[model samples]
Structures are given as C-alpha cells and as structure tokens.
Target: MQRLVKIEMSLFKDILSGISGIFSGSPYRIILSAENKKFYLNAYKGAGAIPFAQLLNKYPQLGDLSVWVNYEKGGTVIPLGNLAYVKKELARLISEEQKNKPEIVIPQEIQQLKPSKMPAGFEIRYSWNDSEKAIQPQLRGEYWGEGTYVSENSYWNMPGFTENDDLWLRKNKIRGQEILEFLRAILPQWQRRSLPVQSEVVLEAEPACTIKINRVRIDSVTCEALWRVNPGSIAEIPSLAGYIIAGSSLGEGFNPAGLPLQTESGQALVEEYIPKTIEKVNEFLLQQHHLGMLDMFQPS
Candidate 1:
C-alpha cells in the first residue's frame, strides 16, 4: 500500500500533487486545493494484497489498479479506466476501495427516534436497508400524551386505534440537512468490511411521552420515575414506557423504599416492584390501545 502510494506521489511530485502526505487513515487521501483547481483523490488497493501480511513474497504488492477521473493521464474513468495496471496508474493514486466501497457506522440523524421532530403525537422511525441500499422513513404511530394526530390518514373525527397491528401514521413530512452532512462525514470513516447502523431525533412535526423506569441509586433502591419526559406530556393520555434504566446515586428527595428481600421474608417484593411496574405499565398500554387485548393481568 505505502509502496504504491509512494510510487503514485513521486509520479505527480511538483505537478499534480505539489505537497503530499503518504497516509491519512486508510486509502491515501490527496487534496489538491488550488485557488482554481480543486480535486479530491482517494486511492487504495485493487485486486492486490499486502505481500507482508499473507507472506505472498513472490506475488506483487499491487498488480492491476483502476485509476479514474481527470488525474488520469491514460484511460477513462469507468469502462476504459477500469483496465489500468498498477504499474500503469503511476499517473494517479490508488485506494483500497477500488472495486467495492467501505462500510461505515450509520449516523444518528438517519436512524433515531427523533424527539425534536415530534409535533405532539407522532414518532418517526428512520431506517435503512444497507444490503439493498435503500433509505426508508416510516411513521410508527407513537406519541406521549395527546394533542393532535397529524398524518394523512388521521381525520378530524377519527376514533382511537383498535386493531391489533402497527398503527401506521401517515402524512408526516421531514427534511434535515444535518442528516446529509452526517452521511457525508461517514464516507471517510467507512471501514473495509463493516456495516453501518442509527437509534433518535426531533423534527418540525413530531414527539416523546415515555417514562424511563430508572434506578437512580446504585448503592440503594432509589429510582427516578420519569426524567426524559416533556413537562406537559404526562397523564393527558397513557404514554408508552421504555426499557428499565439502572445506576444512579441516592440523591436528595429520593426516598429509598424498604422491602422484604428474597431471603428475608416468606414472599419477596424487593426486586419485584420495578420489574412488575414495567410489566403492568406495558400491559395497561395494550388495554389503552383497544378493548379485549387481554383477558386478565398477571396474577399477584
């Protein structure tokens, strides 16, 4: 790799690349920033392997390379330039992503439950299929409390969702420049054989009414009922609960409840409340969706 970059640099010295650095992360990056001329050259290996790593001493470090773009003094960028040999591309630098592009971690903007986007009663599900290379934004019907369900399907006098299914929220519009900029930044961070992945956000037309069952104290049984909530978002309508969060200090105003430990009493309720609260909360959530979702709750 270094050998090929050195060869490419020497060929363009005092010409294409007046100032150069051999390695800037993987894939040699050469930024030709002139007042008028500006070209970004990204170079890497083609069908070539590092002779040292695999101990392929006799095999060439770099054989055939596809050098493209205007820096090419020889072949075309696509069909023609794809035929250049490593020895042939002394005119242009080579990168690792010759035939295939590198994979990177997906940005948060694209894959998260955007809190800011929630207008009152709508949470966007941003997802992507990397295998198919497609970006699809979905309207997963989720909102904390009640305000106005803003979607194309939502009507002025629509009843509450009753069907046991994913209540698809329609008529939500979204546009974020940060998502694009985040995507562009990851292009350089992409690794040779990895995949990208995202998880939350807020847009102009979105919303969060989730009670994070958090353990506020690590040394004791102290908890914060709901912290990641909007002030006006509680009790208006039953909101969904998130996963249980642990690890905090027994701070001021926190009353550590005393309970019968499993070993200390005939029946244990110490480690039971939070977990049971989670179950009951979620159970109640289902009942709120519609009637007859459950015949009975868990027995005491």
Candidate 2:
C-alpha cells in the first residue's frame, strides 16, 4: 500500500532557496566535486550525496534535471532546464492534495526521497564510525590590534566606565599578543619565503572587509601569509584550497612592498573607487612591512 506523507517545509528550505533562480526558465549546469559532496552531505544529512546522472536515471520523472557524471575528472554536472515547468507541476500537485492549506503529499516518506544512486565519479569514503573519529576544527583566538591600543589620557577614557574600559583595553593588548603567537604557530616552512597580502571587501548593508596575509614562502621574493578576520565566527573566511588569493613582490629599499587589490566588486560600484581602495590596502601593508612583519617570511 502507498503511504501519503505531508512534506515538511524545513526539509526543502535549502533546495527551494537555492533553486528558485532556476525558475527563470534559463538552463544551467552545476559540476560538483567529492569535497563539495561532503560539505552538502554534512549540511543536509537526509538528502545525502548521490551522483547527479545516476539520480536522474533512477527517477526518470525528474528528466528535466538533466545531469552528466564524469568519472575521469571526478565531477557530476546537473543541467536544469524546464525549471519553470517543474515548479508549476510541483505547485499543482501540492494544490491537488488536500486542497485545504496547500500541502504536498508523496507516495513514500519524505526522507525516503533521497537519491538512490551514488554519482558515477564520487563515493562516500568515510563511514559513520570514521566520521565520528575525524578531527574537529579548532577554535581560533581573536586579535584586536589598533582597536585596543589606547594612550594614557583623558580623551581615551570613557566617562563613568573607566574600569570596564581599562579591562577591555587590557584585553585588547592580550589579543594583540595572542595574534602574534597564533601567527608564529601557523607559519609555514618553505624556502625562498616572501609575504603575500590580500584583502577583499564585501559591500553589503553592513559593509565589511577582510585582509589576508600569507606567511609561508614559496619563492625567493613571494611568500604567503596566513590571514583571517573574525576568527572562529560565523563569518570566518573559508580555507581556499589550491588558490592564491593574492600575489606580491618585494618593494625597493626605503619603499613599501607592492601589493594589489584582490577584490571583485560588482559592476554597480564606481570603477574609480576600486583603485583608490587598492592604494589604501597597499599603504596599510606597507606600514606592516616597515614594522618587520614581512621579515618573518624570509628564509631562516
């Protein structure tokens, strides 16, 4: 006997939120790697990770979601066409079921709707026991630099909260020291070390930016710096694998090292402002260079 299941809204939250743009009826394809599978699987355990081509073949009804699985390159690609029609069909099915408040019904349990086949190129290498034994990400300490620096003066003191202010000021100092210590710990060992610093600015409702400085040397003059802002926070910058965020070269003596802006601003922003920000970031890096920070990347 077929069972009727009322779909939960939360089950499809991510899929709906992400797939909405496809409804424009524009065709699109997405290629996902094994690492990508792990990330999505971790986020949506119920949906699980399956090969795109295999999935479509098993559920021929989802033919509109064309897919290709490449074994050589270890990737699965999904092409979304007739997306608008798919949305319409889904809406109609939901409407036809129990017509009271617009709920969708399926023949089997909702969780059972997981992809039946693993994508051709990828496999779940880790078992449940292995995952439980995997190393967890470590919590990083925060560093407050200029924000914590205060001069001993009345102007620097807040009214009616001297003690709290002083304590924060002290905490900032502690963070500054911790920042240096953390940097020392993660410093990469490489020959021909030179520091490369880069920054990205996200112009949202609340403007925010991040500056990354790599401290591992890869060449005689180019080194990588480990840079992160808002460490251990929700907005922490993701680790970029096999990607160099920025490139730099040693500057002439008495001159600051040259660094370039590594940001992608949407076309909306004025073009002229981009260079001005690059200049500002380079100037900031130059200040740090003069303070012997860049020396840490030199071959020991």
Candidate 3:
C-alpha cells in the first residue's frame, strides 16, 4: 500500500527548507498554495513491515495518513490501525501553525471603499472610455446585478414580453440611442454615432431590473494617433471602436427583506431583472455622453 500525507508548513524559507530535506528521497513532492495557505506533501510506498509508528515518533503532530494498501500485494502487511489517532494530532498542529503565520494581504483600491452591505454576486469593472485611444480617461464603477456580458448573442431572453411589450420595446430602443449620444459627448472630436441596428430590452423585476443591450454598434474613426511612426501598419484600424457593456442592478438601496422573486418558469428574479438593469446602465452611459465622453478607434 502507498500512503499520502499532507503537512501545512509556514511560508518562512527555513521551515519550507526543513520539510524539503525530510522528503528529499521521494520521487515526487508537491507544494501548493490555496486560500492564502501553503501545503507540503510526500508520496511513498508502504508495507506492514515498515510501520508508520517510527515516522510519528519523529513528527508527533502528523494529522492524517491516507493509505491505500494493494490487496493483491498479499494482505500480509503489518497493520498500523492508529491512522485515526494520527489525524487528530495533525489537526491540532495545523491550527497552531496557522495562528503563528498570518496570511499576506495584497493592497488594492477596492479595499478602500466604505464597507457597504452588498448583495450577493455584485461586481465592478473599469476601462478607458476609449480603450484604443492613448489619451482617453478611464471610468470605473460598481455593477449591481448580474455581471457584464461579453457577447451580444449570449444574453438571456424574457418570457412574458414577447413582441407586445411596448414600454419594454421603447425603453430598449431609447437606451440604444442614449449609449450613442453618451459616446459622442465623451469624445466630441471623434465623429461617430450609435450603430443603426443596435437595440435593447429593459424589463422590471420586483427589487431589481434587467437591461439587455442587443446588437449595439458605434461608428467612428481615430482622431489622430498618439504616435506617428508607420502608416501601412495601421491600415485596417478603426477610427472608432464600440463597447457593448451590459449589467444588472438591485435598484438603489439594499433591501434584505426584498427576497429575489421567481419568474413563472421558476428562474430567479435576477434573470428577469437583467434587461431593465442594462437599460439603466445605458442611461448612465448617456449621462457620460452629456459629460462629453467619446469612443475611439484606429483609422482603417
């Protein structure tokens, strides 16, 4: 039978080096990092003739010994039935080690925000208004509902609306124009309008809304390159590039009692909340347009 045992080690170089020495002869050794903790393990062959008691005597805190003895190898092996006892000791040792070695904290801007109670699945995204334009300013904000969707074709569909929801249909179309106007305002010098074929459907759910931006396109060209080295290298470049940003929201305030509603098809209320949520996003983009933010692309 072969046994696999894992040991939690301090991140200190000396402690890791000592464990490395103990398992030097093993053909394989793995060091893994997860959840801000480090682990060291060794795999070795075992025979009843070689009892684990001898190993435990040297390292009294061994937590567990996952053993797999091959029955075919003749069950004629010495049985060290104290595997459970070893696991108990190992758990104590790991807890003590974790106490001594705290996790490393990486510094980030999000950490500075006020600790507001956020609903589950909320997220934030950031990017330059014109990703391709070097002089463009970056915009960053929190997205409330379902996170942003990358592809236009992958959005979730609404059930009751079908083709008859006039309010839903009208809001969808107005949202598209709002996005175009937003880009023009942001980049006033960049000559581009909303893609003519773009559309969206904003739907309402109890505590949240869904805004689905569909088939959005923006037309524009690069004003001028931040650099001017070569022309042939920039032939296929677009002067204006459009971004299809999508997201959802749980309205303005956090409503703990307002549980997620269920649709007729049994989908979570968040699903129906997508279209109108995205519509609000387009409205926010329109606000940015009023502020004169424009989308940019390289010239073809």
Candidate 4:
C-alpha cells in the first residue's frame, strides 16, 4: 500500500490535521561520534511518517501507528497506477460482485487523491549531551550544503521541547540502550561502507516521487536500519537497512533510511507553506507532489 500517496480524501485530511502536531512534539537528536555537526532529517514530512502521536491522546481512535504514520485506518486504498484505469477496474469488479450477490454497493473510497511529500518513520539518534564532539569540514549529513536531507524526516523538534523526548528503541522490547548498542556494534562497519574515504558524504538526492512500499522482515522488532542513502555506490557498499515499524501486519516492516539528515526551519516553512499553512478546512485537494529540491526520497 505505497502509503496511498495516491491518497484518499479522508486520509489526506487526517494527515493534514496531524501536520502541525508533528512540529509541536519534542524531538531527539542523534550524535554519531565526536562530530558536533547537525544532521538534516525530513522525518515527519517524508513519505510514511506517523505524525498522529501528538493527536492520539485527544483522538483516541488514532491508535497503533505503523511505520507509515500518515495512513489512517479507514480510507479506501486506491490501486497504484493510472487513476482512471484503477477506477474502471474497480467498477468492473464491483459490478461483477453485485451480479453474484444481489446487494447494492459502491466504492466507499470516494475522496480526492493527490500525491504529497510525507514522512517515513523518524530516526532519533541519542547519546549523552556531554559525550564529547568534533566537527568536520562539511556538514555531517548534508549534501554539499544543499537544504535537502539525504535521508527523509518528518519535522524538526521545536525549541523548548527537547528536554525530554528520549524513548527506548524497542526492538524486541529490549532496552533502548541495547538497541543503541546494536547499532554501535555495526556502526564502524556501516560507516566504513556508507561514508567515503575522505569521510565525505556523496550527493544522492531523489525527487518527491512515490514508489511501491517494500516489506522487509525483521524479528518482532522496531529499530533503526543503519544505512546511508547514496545510490549507484551500492555495488561497493555492503548491506543496508532503515527504520522498522512493527506490530501492524499491513505496515509492519522496515522503511529504509540512508544515514544522515539536516533540516532548516524557516526555509522549510517557505517550502512547506501550502501543506503547513492549511488550517481547519472541511476539504482540500493535493495534486501532484511538486516538491522542488526540498524533497528527499519517496518511502515505500
């Protein structure tokens, strides 16, 4: 269900409603090694992000978020491909079903559909604030200072909320520290494979396009998939993985992340104006997701 980026109107509304809330929550930072450099991450707004947490307390119905947070429980999933053909195919199926059953029915997924850049699951890297740090010539996770993040993120955590947002990496329900240790165990190897020789990050940015979601099997767990997003260098690079969202049979799987990300707030507002500025509205339509430069990869 490629997170239904070809969206249902109701799902769109649900996603829009959760946008501000994603920004409203507290955020965690990931500091790898002694580098004080910040990572650019488009976690909340990237494809498959679950931005409904802040609203969950109020909207009790929004429960059990998947790796694909933007998707709501009750939306008709439009088939991926030419919209008209999909509709025509659905019509034919419904007609055929009606002939056999004598009951009148229609596609309830009657909502406008449009592609918008959303988020996959966010990667919150954490260590002690006083863990010691260093700085590199270029930004750690940025692509040649381009505003776009290599890996996708939803929203940057706002000021004043950083006091307490740390949670355990809950893979197999182990201590979050253990999860960190697991990444740390592979950190050296992952870094060697992902980072270039001069310790520089290669540029590998993709347009805001949607693709079919890939389901990766992991043992009853949710942990960070420690791989960078650089494409074309895959031959030399070894294994790669991303964020894992477990529990839900439908969306429970790994969402890939290519290592690093850095986000700029003011600029993001300018880029995200339309979707971000949408306040309370009965309905709104999202056309093609035309995110120029600012968008990262399309998550499955």
Candidate 5:
C-alpha cells in the first residue's frame, strides 16, 4: 500500500505552499513555495536523509507530541500513525484557530461600503464548471470583506489611491532624476501645509495613501518619508499591519503593536496618523542639532 504524505506550509507574503513525497521510500522531502515559482529545501536535508532524531533533539516538543516547531520559516509534517492521533491533532488545530481567530478591525471609511444585507453562511465554493457562481454575487453589488473572487474588483473605497501611479513609475523607470523630481514636487506642498506636522499628505505615486514623504528640520528641513504601506499586494485583508517611521532620526519603531489604524473600505488612515507620530520625531531632531543646524543643513 502506498500513501502520499502531504505537508501544507505557509510562507512569507501570506502565500500558502506545500511539500509532498512518498512517506516511506525517500529520506528527503521536496519543498515548494506557495506560488510554485521557486523550490527550496534545507541544505542539510538535501545533503542526506532528514535527521528526525536530531530534529527531535533540537525540538523537544517532537518527543512528547505536545508541541510543534513554529519557527519563522517552519512548518509541521503530517503525522504518520494511527487515525486516532491524526484526528485528535486536527481537532486541536481547529480549536486553536477558533479560539484565536484574530479580530479584523475595518476602518469606518471602508465599513460604509459593505452591502446592507450580507449573505449569511453562504460561502461561494469554486469548481471548474461553476464559474457562474463566482460572477453572480459581484453583479448583485460589491461589499467589503466578501472574500476572494475572480477579477480585480474592490468595493472598499480608497480615496488616497492614485490611478496608475505605480504603472507610470515602473514604465518610466524611477532613477536619480525621477526620485529628485518626486522630492521637489512634494517639498513645496510640505512647506505650504507643514506636512510632517500634518497626519497625511499625499505623495505623488500610484495608490497615494500607501506612501508619504515628510520634510522635517534638523538644522534645516531634511526630507523624511513616512507611513509606507502596501496592503493591496497581499491576498488577505486581515494581514495589512504596517510600521511607522518614529524617533527624531529617520528610523523605524520596533514596537510590536504596530501602527494602530485599521484599513476598511480599502482606505488606511496612515495619512491621518503620520503627522501625529512624526511631530515628536521632528522636534527631537531639531533640538539634537539646533546648535550647528545651519552648518549641517543640506538642501537636495
């Protein structure tokens, strides 16, 4: 009897991947990335047999089946044994997921885009022949958080998104001159609006809400970019957490809580929060270099 042991894995970018092999014959398991675009395996595992004993030693959780390896680039293989053990572990995974289904907070702006009546418990399952089932709901009307569907359609309203800005940038190929031009265009707006002190100012880019350019003075005003967000690139809406540029110097904050803003209706209030967080950093930078500010100031 030949049974295939398949191991599902999760990769960076919220990409779902898997590894499969003949459980008994080969000592090695071949790993594939989620997009199936690339192949990778542990160098040690490829050189020889997978060291179950050594792995069990390093990860004592394997010994008692009480814990599983949960490293950054890590995943668990399907257990080979009695059906009872398999069933029990599956139940435990499900229970854990149910208990800790992280709450998704949609911003008020996005929430308004949802349909008045959402279909309850009616998940649209996809099949090769049932393509029509996919297109019908969107035709009825669009709503935020309605799960995956075919084609590029979003009900959430992102006022900050600039149409084709990324496409233009990519096609033009941003270089030294392009970067300078971008800075120049944004600087005057900063001067007029006092940008770093303002929570949100649109940088001239595709999907404008995702990026911001700030100018703060040390001795003289230095250009600082803040609130860099790219939620649209991900498959899942719930994973849209991003970092803030904090402190007097141009550096990122290490706080795990991340920026406390929700993206709803596809609009993230990073623009709203940018000014609030950057104000203090700008002040600190000014004070730290106030004495020799003019001498150190360099205009770009």
Candidate 6:
C-alpha cells in the first residue's frame, strides 16, 4: 500500500511569511557551495564581523561564517539590522510547519541601509559544450578545446566581445578563484583540490579577468540525453556539476591540483556515461510520476 501525504497552502504561507524576513535582503551575499556543502556570507567593506556571527547563531546549520573582509574595493555589507530582519522572516516561515515559534523581530537599523552595490571583479561562469575549441585563452598557453560561443551581434551574446566564438578553458585564474571562494561558502563538505604551496604571490599590473575552465567533460551520451530531455537547458546541467566538481577538486580532494576525474578516458568517457545516467534517472522519474508519487509530494 502506498501512503498519501498532503501539504497545506495556508501552512506553507504562514511559514513563508514567518521566515521571509530572515533570508530576505542582501546580507553579504550568501552563497552555498554544493561540493563543500557550506554556506558562506561575504562581508562588505567596513562591515563588522559581529553581524555574521549573529547570523550563524540564529541559523547554525548554515555552517561557520567565513568573513571576507572587503576594503578599498568597496562592496555592500549586510548590517546587523538586516540580519535581524532576515532571522525574523525565517522564523515566521519555519514556525508555520508546527515547528518552534519565532522568537525574533526585524531590527530598525537593518531597514535603514540602501541596497548594496554589486560586488565588482566577480562574474558567474556557466558551462556550455557545443564548440570544439577554447572559448577563452588559458593562463599557461595550453589549448584545450571546450566551452561555447557567444556572439556580440547576436541578441543572446554578451556585449563588448566581437561577434564570434570565444574560448573557455578549465584552470584556476582570478575569475575562477572568485568563483571558488563563492562556492566554498555555499556547499557543505565541498573541498578544493590540493595544489603545490607557492611561496610568492604572482602579481601582474594588469590582472587577467579570465578564468580557465578545464571542467570535466560530461559523457557525450549524458549531454545528448540532457539535451533531449531539457533541450535548451543543457547549460544548466553542466553548471550544477561544475560547482560540485570545482569545490571537490580544490578543497577536499586536493592531491591533484585540478578538477576531480570520474573516469580514465577523460572527457570522452564522461561524455559517454552521463547520458545513460540521465536516461536512467529520467526513466525512474517517469515511473514515479505514473505511480502518483509526484502528486503525493505536491502542495495542496
């Protein structure tokens, strides 16, 4: 016999209303690293460390707050007041589940600050696998064919670059480091691959904003399956894996100094395996659908 479960909308709304204030508003962007499975809170310029500590105290499951002290660069900071609001909001949302009652209120100070500016020198690198060449150049001058093309002339492409294909490599450059730092805060159990400890800092007057992206190529089969199922959504699939692989490669499994490898044949093998896995997973999902499992989980 199958058991049926129902979720009430009113309860969900009550819970959302309760917790809406807690997670809302920008308190130093909270990023969750999938591989590390840790939540990181970035503190803006001149921000006190106390607010972050209070945030963790309110929601201990978010892991320790790794304070990234930004100065001169001048980014936004989540003040203590905002943190209190977020805590109150989250408490309201969670309390509706018949859980613990909310014991917090939004502090007046948090409501005072203007929204923080976008953090500079930071860009989110998403994955694409259509082209057979590097969309961006590598730091070591090694050419590895990966990534996709975004044309300036095309409505889809980002501006500035010429209307042609760009190369993307998988390596740790400045942009990659930024991404790494962002991921480290979000994912629990996520670790970076070990690299040789360097004694000196390589400072270039014009720091290259490019990030090498030697991401493990997913099996072509998996890519095809993902494409077949989601079609235009293939970009999303690799991105999920990229975050997982990036953090795991850097922090936890650090012996290789590169992204972790799932198979021996490298990209070719991954391209082959992922499609089948996706197919199987998709089939299972379909079966669940037919069995009314989806309906059972749906909120009423």
lDDT tens readout by residue for model 3, 232-274: 2221112222222222211111111222221222222243443
Tens digits of lDDT, candidate 5, 65-154: 334322233433321112124334434433553322211221222122222222333232111112221101112222122121111221
lDDT of all predictions: 0.28, 0.27, 0.25, 0.25, 0.27, 0.27
lDDT order, best first, reads 1, 5, 6, 2, 3, 4
Cα-based lDDT at residue 188, candidate 2: 24
> Please, what's the RMSD in Å of model 6?
25.3
* lDDT (tens digit, per residue) of candidate 4 on 1-300: 222222233344544555554445422111101011221111232234333343344333223322222233433222222333433433453356221221111213322322223234422332211111111122222221112222222212221222121221111122223433434443344345432212122223321112221232221111222233322222211122221212111111122223111121111222222232222000111211233413322212
RMSD of 3: 23.7
Descending-TM-score candidate ranking: 3, 4, 2, 5, 6, 1
Model 2, 1-300: lDDT tens per residue?
Answer: 112112233334434554544444222222221122110111111233445555445434445434221233444322112223333454554455331221222212322332222223321111111122211111111111221211111011122222323332223112223322322332221111321111121112221234343232332222222233221121211121111111111111111123332233211223444344335545444644544544432235
Give the deviation of candidate 2 from the true structure as CA RMSD.
Answer: 25.2
Query: Which regions of candidate 6 fall more than 4 Å away from where they truly are?
Result: 1-51, 61-300
Candidate 4, residue 2: Cα displacement in angstroms equals 20
Candidate 1 accuracy as lDDT:
0.28
Clashes of each: 29, 11, 37, 33, 7, 69
In angstroms, give how far residue 197 of model 2 lies from its true place.
25
How well does candidate 1 score on lDDT at residue 244?
A: 16
| TM-score on alpha carbons, each prediction | 0.14, 0.16, 0.18, 0.17, 0.15, 0.15
Task: List where candidate 3 sits over 4 angstroms from the true fold.
Answer: 1-16, 19-31, 34-123, 129-300
TM-score of 1: 0.14
lDDT of 1 by residue, 118-189 (tens): 234433344432332223345533221222222222212123332321222221222233333323443223
